[model samples]
Target: MLFGPRPSCIKRLLVIEDDPLTAFDNEHTLKHAGYDVVATVDSGEAAVRFIAAEQIDALVLDLGLAGDMTGRDVARLARDRGIAVLLVTGRCPEDASDIAMACLDKPHSPSALVAALKALETMICKNRAPRKVAGLTTWWRPAAA
Candidate 1:
């Protein structure tokens, strides 16, 4: 009997956007792209809490949040935990380049967002890291050590 290869693991994603409509769009885009959006929050504080409690594969964050903590702060925390991060913002910050894997401009098309996420996913996979930003039939496997 022949059997197919093992299935790839699903990646869990967290989205943080202050605007309800924008947050909804992000969630929809991620889900439509085959990512499992574990949770969507509007404030940095909530994002931090969610990160602490969940095994997040990646984060899709907005720079300006509803709480005292900024998206940069959350990104910093996530990076420290080895979680991949992508910043989606209207105005990209000079410092964002240091914390996130990539920064995406606002008003982006869903396809653009999916592409960005796929790029991030590729980066993470290259490092033997891992997200569900897009459905990729071909994935990069890390070379043998």
Candidate 2:
């Protein structure tokens, strides 16, 4: 019998922000938090293309993008694919509550961003089949049983 460990599924994240600095910071923060940031793009069109091609698990989006298509438009596409979306913007839109998993205002600390991602991860994990290990519960799947 071929015995092997189960593969771990780390959540894949995509960051869509127009600002170069903000995009870099968000990508760095997500990577530091142990999430795989698949891509960091500055336009809604590019985000759409990336989402279409990549297996994105979650998205951190900015409402105001440099392109004609805003983050809200991208959020719709991401949500349709069952990807968790977090809106981070300087101004919160009224409809934001309807679309995203959560909204974080701009000037948010890195800790806040990390906390939001953790919360989203927990929520995602809870929705799936759970497993217990060492007297604790985790949503992460092991490589082998």
For candidate 1, write residues 58-87 as lDDT tens digits: 898888999899888999999899887888
How close is each model in CA RMSD to the real structure?
6.6, 8.8
Each candidate's TM vs. the true structure? 0.80, 0.78
Residue pairs whose backbone atoms clash in candidate 2: 5-143, 5-144, 6-143, 6-144, 7-143
Note the Cα lDDT for every prediction shown.
0.77, 0.73
Model 2 TM-score, all chains together: 0.78
Judge candidate 1 at residue 5 and give its lDDT.
Answer: 23
Q: Which stretches of candidate 1 lie over 4 Å from their true place?
A: 1-10, 127-145
lDDT for 81 (candidate 2): 85
How many clashes does each candidate structure show, in the order listed? 0, 5
